[model samples]
Target: MGLPGEMRVVEISGPGGPEVLVPAVRKVPQPAAGEILIRVRAAGVNRPDLLQRAGSYAPPPGASDLPGLEAAGEVAAVGAGVSRWKVGDEVCALLPGGGYAEYVVTPADHALPVPEPLGMIEAAGLCETFFTVWSNVFERGRLTAGESLLIHGGSSGIGTTAIQIARARGVRVFVTAGTEAKCHACLELGAEMAINHREADFVAAVKDATGGRGVDVILDMVGGDYLPRDVRALAPDGRLVMIAHQKGAEVSMNFSLVMVKRLTITGSTLRPQSVEAKARIAEGLFREVWPLLDTGRIAPVIAESYPLEQAAEAHARLESGQVAGKIILEVA
Candidate 1:
């Protein structure tokens, strides 16, 4: 099949709000060596996309200015030295940028076969959150079986994924959400406990829950005021992995507590990582996590989906703080 010379896309018209995500068209991207061009069937909406739209984030060097970070589709073309996939293979991939289009190009190593019995919509939601969770929670945080983890945003895409993967591997999971309904959703997804942060202090709750031992690790997205509280919520040698700061980033943190508790504080943004590093994460997902997805042990909790053209609406839904899981943009 011949690839189109141009394709449809939703580009950031300006840096402000969800209304800036306007439908447009762009030339279809072509794959380079070790890359594959995908006819994108669906794209996942994430917080990073929101940041990019708000002019707070920018695509890494040599990446498209488009906002999306992950997508699922069929392989339309393969570049030189790309033999792992062929034309017509279905895959979900972690993109550097440019997923909000009908076509996108990403390294072949970043793409994985669509897991059994799941279509493009679910597959589209897989790579970004799974990669973030695996690299942050397991590799960086060193969370292991029998350990206890406290996730700050339990109802989010990353939170839900972390809960399932940690639980499936024998780790106990706890999460904090803003609402009771969100708490229930997290509980249903294998979280051992769900704390409504709006009603109670998470630090107190964690200390009480663990008999004052605190948690083995904390996956925190809320920074600022939560830093001091998180220090109080961790056990000796506990790890805290921050993936974002919905709250402000600047904080007056006391290193004394960190030293006394022997704690580790770290965080990462997935978009700017090297392709080689991302490929390693992809390998881990294929070996350790794909089976769970294939067997239906854990699935993408799709809160809602919108047509490709309704990207503004999708972004609005995500920002509304009412969504429990992923928001997908259907392209095909």
Candidate 2:
């Protein structure tokens, strides 16, 4: 069957709030060389999407203006030089941008087969957080088996993923959440300790849990005031990978503390990364993590889902701070 001439999409109608995500129609994107077009079934809502909508983050040059970083769907077309996927293959891909539509195009290597255990909605939430965590927590942070790790935003999609993967790999996991319920959720997800940040300082709790040695690695998204405290919570030779600074990026911190602790502070935002870099992350996930997912040892935690047209509502829900996991928009 021939493809449609146009498809439904939600565009960022100028920078503002959720209401700026308005419904529209656009021509179905054609797959370029080594690229594949996906007929999107569902898309994940992420903090980066919110930032893009707010005008703080802009789509990379030559990328779509739409605001989606991950999506799951079936192959609708395959571009020249693409061999790994064909039309109708179900895939969930780490997209550079332009996922907020009925169809989207991305490099073939950036797409992975939707694990046998996950459906479209579940798979939609996989790429962004999984890629982020795997790269930041394991590759950049150099977290290893038998080490201790601390994750901020323990109830978030990235936090839940890091908990399971770390536990499965024999790393002790600790997490911080704003509420008791969120803490409980993290604990259930294999965190050895979930500290309710509202009740106790995470640094002190992690130090106490680790017998005052501090953790080996810290994955933080909240910058601002938490910066110096993150330093205090690290063991000697610890690594801190900052993937997001939701509170604000500019902050005062003690570099001397970082130097004395022999800490490595590094971070990467996925969107601006090269396609080859993301492909490497995808390869790592397939080699090391897919089996756990296939066996149900780890799964995507979906907090809520809304129909495609209700993207505004979905964004509002995610920004509401009540969601403990990923929010999805079902497009199929």
lDDT of 2 by residue, 1-332 (tens): 99999999999999999999999999999999999999999999999999899999989999998999999999999999998999999999999898899999999999999989889999999999999999999999989999999999999989988998999999999998998889999988889999888888988898898889999999999988888999999999999889888888999886998989899999998888998899999999999999999898889999899998999999898888888989999998
Q: Would you give me the overall lDDT of model 2? A: 0.93
Residue 316 Cα positional deviation in candidate 2, in Å, after optimal superposition: 0.7
Whole-model lDDT, candidate 1? 0.94
By summed lDDT, the worst window of 10 consecutive residues in model 1 runs over 1-10
With candidate 2 superimposed using the best TM-score fit, by how many Å does residue 11's alpha carbon deviate from the native? Answer: 0.8
**Collision pairs in model 2:** none
RMSD in angstroms between candidate 2 and the native structure over all alpha carbons: 0.8
